[model samples]
Target: MNPINYLYLSALLFTIGGAGVLFRRNAIIVFMCVELMLNACNLAFVTFARLHGNLDGQIFAFFTMVVAAAEVVVGLAIIVTFFRSRHSASVDDASLMKL
Candidate 1:
């Protein structure tokens, strides 16, 4: 398969995720969309690494996954805390948080 194809697929995934983040109101769905974007990036990274016959991109993707894991931990914690207080998980509600 051509590297350009992988790049196109990555762009498509990232665009879908961006649209989801922009249009979705639910916190969880938005979070998942962000994850989708990250995975799209990972896909591109791996494809390029393979094309170049090098491991650097794959290593970066590994670190990206680690960072994404940490993001999920902290993001879900905050979401859970907000839900506990408000009994909802809408991003609109989170915008009003003060202090």
Candidate 2:
């Protein structure tokens, strides 16, 4: 397996995630897409780490995963609150930030 293949896979995953974020109205789906993007990045990180014979990329991926976990916790809380108030998790309906 070539390292470039991993990069190609990562690119595909990122493209799909980006498209989902742009086109999906459901907050949960959008969130999952964002996670997909993050995992794609993680895959790239590990691939590069293996290629370079160093731990730096793996360390970065670990930190990224930690941050992503925290994001999931906070994002879900906000989404749940929005759903409770509006009875839906559509991104279009979350106008709480509007001035």
Candidate 3:
């Protein structure tokens, strides 16, 4: 596939993920959106790495995946704790935690 095609596909996936994050009310869905966005970024990174004939972008993508994994663990812990305390997984309900 062409690099441009890969770039366009990555952009589309990222856009959809962004919309999901902005409009979704469910915490799990929001998390999934975040994952989608992260993967899209990884795709772009790999595409650029291949296009440039360099390992740096691929290494960056690897680090991004590692960070994303850590984020998932921490994010899920927070979500689980919030659900346990509030009994609702709705994003709006989470605002109550500010107080």
TM-score of each: 0.94, 0.93, 0.94
Question: Residue 26 in model 1: shift from native, Å?
Answer: 0.5
Q: Which ranges in model 2 have alpha carbons more than 4 Å from their true place?
A: 96-99
Point out the higher-scoring one by TM-score: 1 or 2: 1
State each candidate's clash count: 0, 0, 0
What stretches of model 1 exceed 4 Å from their correct place? 97-99
Write candidate 2's Cα lDDT for 1-99 as tens digits. Answer: 667999999999999999999999999999999999999999999989999999999999999999999999999999999899999999898787998
lDDT of predicted model 2: 0.95
Most TM-score-accurate candidate: 3
Q: What is the alpha-carbon lDDT for the whole of candidate 1?
A: 0.96
Ranking by lDDT: 1, 2, 3
Q: Cα lDDT of all candidates, in order?
A: 0.96, 0.95, 0.95
Candidate 3 lDDT (Cα, 0 to 1): 0.95
TM-score of 2: 0.93
Model 3: runs farther than 4 Å from truth?
97-99
Report the lDDT tens digits of candidate 1 across residue range 5-98. 9999999999999999999999999999999999999999999999999999999999999999999999999999999999999988876656
